[model samples]
Target chain A: MKPGTGPLLRVAGVVPGLWLAGFFLLPLAFVWILSFGEKQGLVAVDIVWTADNYLRALDPLYLGILAKSLWIAALTTVICLATGLPVALGIVFAPPRWRPLLLLLVILPFWTNLLIRTYALIAVLRTRGHVNATLGWASELFGLPFEPLSLLYTNTAVVAGLVYVHLPFMVLPLYATLHRLDRSLVEAAADLGAGHLRVCITIILPLAVPGIVSGSLLVFVPALGSYLTPDLLGGPDSQMIANVIERQFKSANDWPFGSALSFLLMYVTFGALALRSLSVRRPAAR
Target chain B: MTEAVRVGGICKRFGAVTALAEVSLRIEAGEFFALLGPSGCGKSTLLRIMAGLEHPDQGSVFIDGIDVGRTPANRRPVNMVFQSYALFPHMSVRSNVAYGLRVTGTGRAEAHERAEAALGLVRLTGYGERMPHQLSGGESQRVALARALVKRPRVLLLDEPLSALDARLRDEMRLELVTLQKTVGITFIIVTHDQEEALSMADRVAVMETGRIRQVAPPAELYEAPADRFVATFIGQVNLFPATIGADGTAQAHPFPGVTARARGIGAGRQVWIAVRPEKITMAPRGGVPAGRLSGVVEEVVYRGDLSVYLVRCMAGPDGLVRVSRANAARTADRLPGPGTEVVLDWAEDCAVVLAS
Candidate 1:
């Protein structure tokens, strides 16, 4: 026992610890317990233990939706990294005076409500919206025949919305890591006869792995569980597992089945994350 | 013998500050040259220009008598060991050393073999598998050196290569660097601010000040006959006196009793500065002042291990203290003058250097 740390540390840990125990852990424990129960009636569950909910949750229909959700999440993560890495690099290498302003712009999307931002994206992506209208105007001006392009209510729109909403999550961590990168290391690489692309491939990307992993995890986890974007922008075929979970809890009135589905989704997310961490760690440990 | 590098009237300006102003020098092949100066004196800028990392606004650079003024750093036949060493933290020492070769499209096996050989040259043979973060500072520094040397460039530029090490490690590395330079026998240009490091390692040193080269000469010539006052003081401790030359070519200063030194190439009655090294001046117990000798009271005595320095306030010449250092040959403290003890200071007339103001 260190002298000063005894009481103060315990006091500091009390509020957050109690909050996690009350709000987070308690509900998670309740959900786990409910997953084993049987649905008795609408919005009601019997306390009798059963494996029926797990078996139902594993049906091929639900499994297909889970696979679709995984694919969409993976695609969103790839798009975010490809786009966010360049913007992060630009911000990190900008002049010191412009760095704070650029970083503020990167995070400025967070200041607005995410739902409102998604609706705004709808205004741009809809069939009769800004993008199609602009293309119509350009076609008319060029005297070429054209039809309105249907972009909304598609899986592409859902992925686009997810990328737009989660991009900052990718950029911020990458920026934080790139900001501390030693400039002399880049200069040394050039001095040792490495071209610009070679330097990025050999030095910059390898050093930024931690940032990449963290950013990917942040995007992938939230994209997997995203409900609003798929519901608002996706068509019937583009509906993800989150939409099914929402239906189970809301209209279907299957609380035990919903709990089982949610827990299953949580397990899949954890497994994906564990696999990613293992892959990222093995190369670094070498 | 063709010179390895020839820089001609190079000038660079960054915004409002002129970093290098028409700096020109030539480095011979297989020579170990040093650019010695204080911070912001353009020594590092000159080294970067030679490495093709910096562009000169006004002049040209020639490597191996070929004009390479417009070449990019990656295409130049030169490399630099940065002051920070800048070892890639994520890569093993082998990969870090082999990166340059790999970038040039060498086979992986050959690159690794060459990297291992270069590491052996730095006496870090078994350190190839260790990551940069796992090594000590000295080990990382050696890895950086090996990485740069593996390219076998025509010239090597080191920017304050030893400023990061502790005193003991720095001394040991200094000796190793000298031996390495001799074995490799390439044109090595090292930038340093430490006068002792420059003096001990460089075959020729160019002293710079305020973006201009003050003097460039061999270490012995630079120490014994500095071209200007900055070189005289920047290289070592010295006492400078404002003196006037007589019609008979004799120089007289206020601090000395009579004629102190001979002035050459100066008109009669013109004022000049005379510099005398502290070690050249001899201190003796007070007596009647002799001709051309100055007498004063010892103001302070700083006793280093192998030498003792006496600061004497001159009563006969200038209104300033003249410093004199004596080798500590015996354990007789009583024989050396203490504070308030009267002392006489004298130096050979030929030992004083006449300089422009």
Candidate 2:
């Protein structure tokens, strides 16, 4: 190392390392340790051995919640990809002067609090809200048979909210990756006698796989852990594992089971991520 | 003889800037041509117009006598090796070369076979399994060539294909490219700003300036008889002296204490510029050719490996100076002109070009 890279470097790096250890790592470690213990009253049991919590959490009720959570997460990822690819491509194709402005708009929703954004969905989905009011006006003007629509407290509403909130996370990285792609690659494909559609499928799409994978991870993982959107916009049938975990921690006061559920969720998340990296790793290696 | 490509009065404008204006050129079959210019001279833009990647606002692009004004780039029978090579980073070299064939609905085995053969054409056999990033810069450039060649286009456009390589690599690749063109027997249009690369490799060079081609000639002809002041300066280094034409078809350029050249043909009272190559100007001891003599002091001497350059302060104008380069063979330690040493500069009248503008 260089001579002056001593005191200033340690102050800049070591301080952040200490803070992460004290704050993020410590809480996660406590939760992990708590997951291995049994619940007596409001605290864990004295014994440090247990597989029962994990096996019980895999019971029908919690498993059903897991299925619902995975399904919602998968759907949100699909919707984000379907919508975000075009937005990302548009940003990449925009003029250099306009690109930053367009990106700022893509990320604008994140500036508002997540809770406020989710609640804004509720306000819009209400019976007399903007959507229903527009439909009612269209019906009155066209003389079609129509009434006020019901969209609130539905699975569709929950997915719409999830997509709205997580879209920037998917789009920003996709835009960055696509922007780095050489325009000459597309021209080369075309010069090789590939039509526009062929160029997109054979060259552009395959080259952008990294971006798609990253965007999917950004959208899917967070949607799996989401509770507020579903709680506010979804009916009882659509509640995910997070809602169950929230209930165990808050309503039931079952800290041990809640801790176990949290660890199980983390295991599933890491397992899915590990599988994704493994699958994509081989093609990249070649 | 077939005209492989024809560009007719093409003009392109990007907002307010004119990139190409009324540009026209015909590339014959099996010929190698080069567009030589500096950056922002619109050589690339003209090449793009011919390749159908860009459309000219005022004219048409024809390939093999086919009007391809509205035809898309894929429909044109041409391929381009981009300046950066533009190899697909995610795909293996084989897959990248095979991409053109696969997109055209060629069978899988045949595409692979042709791709291999194309790779072999560039002397990159057995490099199919490696990704673009794994290969060296020259290897990637070869793969890009293979990818374009696999499609078997009638015309090949090379956009400064050797510019990315180091000096030694560039020299090696220049010969390789010339040989490759001969082996392929296809029409090749290359764009370059390197004067040596253009002169050494191209059969014919089109010198461009300000969105226009100033002259198109063989490299030797262009170097010997440049059309204008810009061409004279752009093609090679030259010393220019402002002069005036006389009524009796005589021109005068005085770069000495009291001497001038009685140049011919140009009318009187017109301003002209006389250009002479540095090698054309010869230096000698204080008084050799009294008729063409110019007394000057040696300002600086730059002794290059093969030649020595002398910057002389002449007496025609107070601050006028001219440069002359001599071969390193005749070495005289005693008469070596240093700073403040008096000398005479002289050149044959036939060696200079007088231009009236």
Q: Estimate each model's TM-score.
A: 0.93, 0.91
* RMSD after CA superposition, every candidate: 2.6, 3.1
Range of the 10 consecutive residues with the lowest summed lDDT in candidate 2 chain B = B254-263
- Clash-forming residue pairs, model 2: B246-B268, B251-B263, B256-B316
How well docked is model 2, in DockQ terms? Answer: 0.75
lDDT of 2 by residue, B48-75 (tens): 9888898888988889999999988988
Question: Which stretches of model 2 miss by more than 4 angstroms?
Answer: A1-5, A12-18, A41-49, A126-150, A276-284, B255-265, B286-299, B316-319, B329-346
lDDT at position A198, candidate 1: 87
User: Considering chain A alone, what is the TM-score of candidate 1?
Assistant: 0.95
For candidate 2, state the interface root-mean-square deviation in angstroms to 1 decimal. 0.9
